[model samples]
Each structure stands twice: as C-alpha cells, then as structure tokens.
Target: MEIIKINDFNNHTLSESDIIKRILSGEKELYEILLRRNNQKLYRVIRSYISNTAEIEDIMQNTYLKSYEKLYQFKHHSSYSTWLIRIGINEALARLKTKSKVLHLNTAQNLNSNSILERPDTSQLNPESKIIRKEAKQLLEKTIDSLDTKYKTVYILKEVEEMSIKDIANCLNISTANTKVRLHRAKHMLKEKLFEITTNVDIFEFGFSKCDDLTEKIMSIILKN
Candidate 1:
C-alpha cells in the first residue's frame, strides 16, 4: 500500500467548503485534505489519554474512519476541523475505556479538590531551574493520565489544543460554564500533580514551548504539503 504524507495534501488553494463539496460528491482524494489538516491535532489530543503507541495509532485511524463515515451527516454549522476533532475525542475516550479495563486502571478518582489545594507554587522561576521543573512535569503528566476521561478531554482541548471554552463546549456538546469549570479543575489537578514532585517550580514553562514547537512543525508540514 502507498503511504500518504500529510504534507502532500493540497488544501491550501481550496476553501474548506469547496473540499467538503468535492468529498460529498465522491472525490475521495479530497478527504486527504481533512486528514492532513487535522491529523497532528488529533494525534496530540489522543496522546494525552493514551500511553500505548499502538493503541494511539489504532484510535487515530479509527477516528478518521468514523469521520469519513459520518461526513454526510456533518451540517457544517462549525468548521469541518471542529467536527473531526469531536469524532477523534469520542474515539479516543472509547479506546481509553477499553484499555482501562484491560489494565485494571481506575481513572475516575484521580482529580481531587483537596489534592489540588495542597499543591506547590511554581508561578515564577528562573530558566536554570528547569531540571527540577522537568522532573515535576513528568509527575504532572502521570497525574494527568490518572484523571477521568471527561476532565482529561477538557484539559487537553483547552490547555494543550488552546481551544476556547465556547469551542470546547461545542465540540463536546456541553455548556460553556461546564467547560470553564472543568478547565479550572483540570489546572488545579495538574498543579497538585506537579506539587508532589517539587515544592516551588514553573510548570507552564516546560510544556508550552514544546507545544509551540510542535505546532510550528505541523504548520510547516501542512504548507509544504
């Protein structure tokens, strides 16, 4: 089988509407546009909840298949990218549930309010302090992995994806207020997780730069495609 490089997808010249029209009219190649456009975002989102590389790949492929199958039902009320992300989240959660059972993991009780309140303070720190911060970040990642599916999804969408609360609400089919609350709680949970590792450290400094780099790489790849 010939592998498709997302960088080679030609969505730059065509508007999303035009691509959707083509896809609806049986232009299979146009589907590549959607795949390329959202693959990295989907991958990042899935990776937050899925540690197993094989399962992550399987869920991502399944998400695309589901998106393609449900294309006709898309009303275009929001961008197709948004719709695709919703599908990806659903697929990721479903896969996580199955994997949780197999691994005998209980993710529901991970985000406790008392735990967050007891976390350390890391709002200000020097660059030289990154070594300790890096270890703390690993602890944070593990804690985030322990959160319930709902909270994890909200955190990944809001923090990692940098999506607005309104956008997250639409994507998750939930209320804006709920999305805000979930995000707040998720941040608190992350702080608690990091606190256990280091008393005083900067958490955001570690991941945001890496995420920015990844975003730039994805954009460069898309433009090249």
Candidate 2:
C-alpha cells in the first residue's frame, strides 16, 4: 500500500497531543482526525442538553471550529476528548442561557415540539418486534430526557458515553463526590432497573451520514484557513 497522505488517518498509536503539536506546527489536516474521533461523544453530550437538531449541528460546528482556534492553549491536563466535551457542554449551555433570556422576554406561546430521537428502521424485524422496540426506545429516551439538566448531563456521560466517574467529574469541573452524587441521583430519578435494560441502546445517534456531513463542513472551513 502507498504511504498515507499527510491528511490521511493511519496509525492508531499517536496520542491526540502528538497530533495537535503537528497540526500547530503546520499539518492542519490532521485536525480532521480529532474531529471525527470525538464527534459521537460530543454530539451525545450536547444532545443530552439540547434537543433541537439544527441548533445541535450549529453548536457542533462551532465547537469544532472553536477548538481548532484555541488548540494552541490546550494544556494536556486532560484528554483531548474531555477538553472537547467540556467545550461542547459550555457552548450548548450558553446557547440555552441565551434562549432562556429570549423566552423570558417574549413570554412566547408553546414552542414547536420535535422529537430528537431517530426512529429505528426495522425493515427486517417483524411488525410486533418493531413496535415493541420502538416504544421501548421512546420510553427510555423520554425517561432520560425528563431528568434535570445537571443530572441528565452526568447520567448521559456515565451511562451513555460509558465514561468513568472521575473523567465525568473532570469534564464537568465538579468534585468526584459531587459527580458520584449526581450520578446516583440521576439513576434514582430514572428509577431502578431502567438503567439495566437501556445499557446498550444507542439513544441519540449521530448517524454516519450526519457525522460525515458535519465533519466535511468543518474540514472545508479549516482547510481554507
């Protein structure tokens, strides 16, 4: 096989710090790998806070671009994924803050209600199985969505993203004990036994097509710089 291009993804061994150094030193294309690597986790983290698809994509784009702009300042104190997740969380929360203010000003009527969960395309499954799986997924998503913002975020990070408690604490800038408390509270609020059944379900999926489109949009902008 030909040697990998400067922009191509190759070895799995290089740490994100190594890639960031190279990107800073002038191999900017490598940034695409970082974007792709963290896209799903970042998307899920943001999705747990915000349900609007358009706004989620906007925040994802801004997070990728903002991270690239501030890449030089990354201190390596945490994994790049953690750092990026923190940025995505901040952006989503900020958007919500601004939105809350707008709603407060307008005292608007009820806003549009659109579902963020993707309905499973169960073409191969029998009708009965399809109905069962779909309802279960909806109920699970709604249950998780019912959580307060603080608890929902920690819950998604711990249960859905499969992150450790310490990592979740670091990302949220909370103490380990606080992280554990929030997670415990979240599980309790979700009710017992629900977590067990929903363990493997992919709730707010960032589909491959959606990911590629977002990645390319950001990549195109990066390459232009």
Question: Per-model C-alpha lDDT, please?
Answer: 0.72, 0.79
- For residues 84-200, write the lDDT of model 2, one tens digit per residue: 999999999899899888876333222224433454484798755666666666677777777777998899888877899889999999999999999999989888547654574
Query: Candidate 1: lDDT of 151?
Result: 89
Off by over 4 Å in 2: 1-13, 105-127, 192-225
Q: lDDT tens digits, residues 1-225, model 1?
A: 233356658446667787787888877887888777777667667766666667667988998998888788988678777788788778877876786789776444342221211235567766535545654455566677777667888897777677788888988899999998988888888778667645646545555555666788999999999
TM-score, one value per model: 0.65, 0.72
Using TM-score, give the best candidate's number: 2
Error of 1 at 11 (Å): 5.9
List the pairs of residues colliding in candidate 2.
Answer: none
Q: Clashes per prediction?
A: 1, 0
